[model samples]
Target chain A: AQSVSQHNHHVILSEAASLELGCNYSYGGTVNLFWYVQYPGQHLQLLLKYFSGDPLVKGIKGFEAEFIKSKFSFNLRKPSVQWSDTAEYFCAVKAGRNQGGKLIFGQGTELSVKP
Target chain B: EPEVTQTPSHQVTQMGQEVILRCVPISNHLYFYWYRQILGQKVEFLVSFYNNEISEKSEIFDDQFSVERPDGSNFTLKIRSTKLEDSAMYFCASSRLAGRNGELFFGEGSRLTVL
Candidate 1:
């Protein structure tokens, strides 16, 4: 079956540190990729998405992700992290043929930014 | 800005008891979805609905689980007989379009604890 994998489970970084979270998917067809974030006590919210365009997609909160078709990867990155950036990040993919737009999500990566 | 809303922020129920989680999706959205995240696990898709019918469902959505858009404003997921494993955070989401390219808006989830 198709699946999404996030390599890091927990990442700790100091404020202003650069960050990257790895994601890979196993679908063989066209895909729509997304990154979502959940802050403490908040609902899941979209950070960025990749439909079909330039491989580099920029999202909210100074976050960006690159879709590398060859590697089946869409990795999230941030240049400078803030203490407020501590949250759980999830990577998701939707197969092109799926009519319902159901998403397959990766096990989330928890990032803790210490001040 | 319009957003999805879920009721009963938290619920605790005995195993085998029936439970109904409710949601009100953004008024303009055409597609509705249900997803769940078990404690310390990845977010998993449960089902998707459109045009008053189910568009798709995952294996996790079995006979014990059912979804209904009972009215113009209310979407509900009913678990006929909850199991201990059913304890998780249930989220409701909606999108303006199908899988091609539409951002999903999610509601604050309802945390269910099946004791």
Candidate 2:
């Protein structure tokens, strides 16, 4: 079975601080990676996705993720985060072929950016 | 922009009662999906529907749970006999295609509270 693991449960940062959230997946075949974000009272929205292109993918709201196939990791990064960027982030993966595009999500990471 | 919509932002039902959560996926989407997030737990995929039938389902989607696209636009998840453990936030999503590469649009979740 494919599973996603997010190393950070909660992260606190000051405004303008660099941020990186670790995500790892256990899947052997080809996979798609994604980063989704949920504001306090909003729905989960896609931030970025990686299918078969470059390893580094840029997303909305100044977010980006790097897909490292060898490490089985796709980590989210932001050069400088703002207080408005505080939200819950999720890492998801879809195993290629035969899986019917089912996305397995990791336990979310709660990001608190202090202004 | 078009977005997925779900009804009854919150639902409270008794054990043994049947609860139906409704969703209206984005227009023109070809694939529908249901997922649940228990409080303090990871979001888990329940089922995926395509071509008016179930294409894939996780173990969490057992005989007690079923999904249907009754009309042309509404997709629903039905729980035959709800249990306390069934209490969670249910999310509805849709995509234009089915594959590792497709992106899913999710609705603001419907919270289910079974007592």
* Alpha-carbon shift of residue A11 in model 1 (angstroms): 0.6
lDDT of 2 by residue, A21-102 (tens): 9999999998989999999978999999998789999999899999999999999999999999999999999885775768
Docking class of 2: high
Please, what are the lDDT tens digits per residue for candidate 1 over residues A1-115? 8899999999999999999999999988999999999998888999999998899999999999999999999999999999999999999988857545888899999999999
lDDT over C-alpha atoms for residue A82 of model 1: 100
lDDT of each: 0.94, 0.95
Error of 2 at B110 (Å): 0.5
TM-score of each candidate structure, all chains considered together: 0.98, 0.98
State residue A68's C-alpha deviation in candidate 1, in Å: 1.0
All candidates' chain B TM-scores are 0.98, 0.98
For candidate 2, give the lDDT.
0.95
Worst 10 residues of 2 chain A by lDDT: A94-103
